[model samples]
Target: MYQLAPNIELLFTEAGPDAADRVRAAAAAGFDAVEMWGTSDKDVASLAGALQETGVSLTSLLAEPRTNFTLPGTDLGPFFTGLDRAVENAGLLGCPRVVLGSGIGFPGAKRPQNLARLVEVFTEAVERTRGSGVRLVLEPVNTRVDHPGALLDRTADAVLVAREVGSDSFGLLYDLYHSITEGEDPAAELANAAGLVDYVQIADAPGRGEPGSGAIDWAERLSVLRASGYDGPIGLEYFPTTPSVESLAHIKAVARDA
Candidate 1:
């Protein structure tokens, strides 16, 4: 069975706003792992304490104040600074990965040129976070629905960037929801991106809701994922149509069979 990490930002909000309490709620729900977006707004001390007390692992968190490498003359100092802070917080929370994004590309630049620039920026980002015991995973968000105009939308493109970056510390975050929303075939994409995906997240397509609430065949998809050789924790990053626990029933059962 694949270990599932529910995203606290979207799941378990029934526990209230304090992320620390959410950690507790996720634990009570029998989750041993959780993920979140940014840490800046959270009570780090309490969150860390909750994780320690509950023995729940933080799978990953976002690299904040995302830098748009495609934007000409964009200052990268803040991005690196934010990365450093993120690494520090990850250390505190025992998080293993930091998710990075290629913000909207420069309007006037060619796609190849923008992607090349990403290679340079992420190369340095890997170096900057070296020895932190934190792996960097670049995510390709869908532009069509959730993230309009996002520079990196295709899983193939993200795999290319991760390949170009050429660091063991850097890899790809294959979000099944985004890939499906962007109209790519999961089996084909996962096949091409095999061995490079360090993390995976999921939500049902057509509405980005919990698994059974949408059209995806979880058993088939999970089988394809396993076939791709990614035996890692899958982050449950979907919005629930019902209570969080109730929303998980389908995927949890499907995953167990998968």
Candidate 2:
């Protein structure tokens, strides 16, 4: 079975105030792994200690400062600074992946032009993290619901950039919620994204909540991802209508079956 990693940032709030406490909460919820947004501002030492105490592996985190990737002549200094911190902190937590977003679309810029810049940025990032064992993943967020004007909302665009960048340390994150929210069928999209995805994130559509609360057939989704031969940890990055534990009841079984 593919390993499950709970997003402690959005899920597992029952664990309480401190992020380390949330790590413990995820462990208690029966997940052997946990993920977060960025570890830069958090207590990495304490979080590391909790992971050691609970034996939960840190799977992934966001590329800090949420660097945007759409403009041609935009300054990348701030983004790389944040990336450096993200790498150091992720190494401390023993995480191997960091998520990046394709900021907003550039005004008066062609898609190809922006994508070229995106590839260049990720290429440099890939070089920076080379030998550190950390992989950079570009994620596509939905525009209609959560993120309007988001440059790379389609999974295919992420696939394009990842392919153009062409590095083992860089790939796309196939987010099921965003795909469904965009009205694209996962079964069809997964076929094209089969080899390009470095990680998987899922929340149901409509409310971005638990699997059973929305319209996605997770069993079919997971089965399709499996057929794509993706065996990485699937991040359950969702909001729960009830307690986090209660939310997992439906998808946990689906994951087990997957």
Candidate 3:
């Protein structure tokens, strides 16, 4: 089974949901690794201290503050600034990967043109993070479900963007729930993703709930992951149906079944 990195940003809200509190809560919930989003806007000292105290490893975080990646007109200055800050924080947290949300599609532009702009910006982003020990993965969300009009919703598109970037520093975030929501076959997609995936995240489709709460076959999903030899952390980025500890029953079930 893949090591699970609980997304503290989406889980562990019972303990005040403060960044450090989430880290401590994830550890208390028996998770050894955790991922976060928007950690740059949080108290890094406290978060870093909590990780140190709990001995929890940081898995991944967002590359920049959430913004539209598909737009050619939007100024990338703030995005790049946020990326630099995130890289620095990743260094402090010992996080190896960061995720990028390929935002909603651009209005009044062809898809190729939008992708072209995205490639250009990410090219610069990859260069900017050179030697930072931090790598990037473009995260593809499902447009038909949770994210309408989201660009880069397909795993293939993210892989294509990473290929165009042509840098080892860039890769794809294969989120299973999103792919399933988008009506993708997870196993075939993972097989297609083969070499370009840097990270993985999971949630159940239809409601974005815990693994077993929806129609997703996590057993099959994990099987494909194992077959693909994906060594990266699999983030538990889902909404719990109950208390945080109670939410982990699925993880236990997965381990036992595996």
Cα TM-score per model: 0.97, 0.95, 0.94
Q: How far out, in Å, is residue 51 in model 1?
A: 0.3
Q: Each candidate: what lDDT?
A: 0.91, 0.85, 0.82
All models, RMSD in angstroms? 1.2, 1.6, 1.7
Highest lDDT scorer: 1
The residue pairs that clash in candidate 1, if any, are none
Put down candidate 2 lDDT per residue, 51-122, tens digits, no spaces: 999999998898767745444557677788888888888889888888888887556778888777788888
Cα displacement (angstroms), candidate 3, residue 253, comes to 2.7
Candidate 2 stretches greater than 4 Å from native: 69-73
Please provide, for model 1 over 87-106, each residue's C-alpha lDDT reduced to its tens digit, 9 standing for 90 to 100: 99999999999999899875
Q: Provide the clashing-pair count of each candidate structure.
A: 0, 0, 0
Model 1: runs farther than 4 Å from truth?
A: 67-72
lDDT score, residue 207, model 3? Answer: 91
Model 1 TM-score, 2 decimals: 0.97
The top-ranked prediction according to TM-score is 1
lDDT of residue 25 for candidate 1? 97
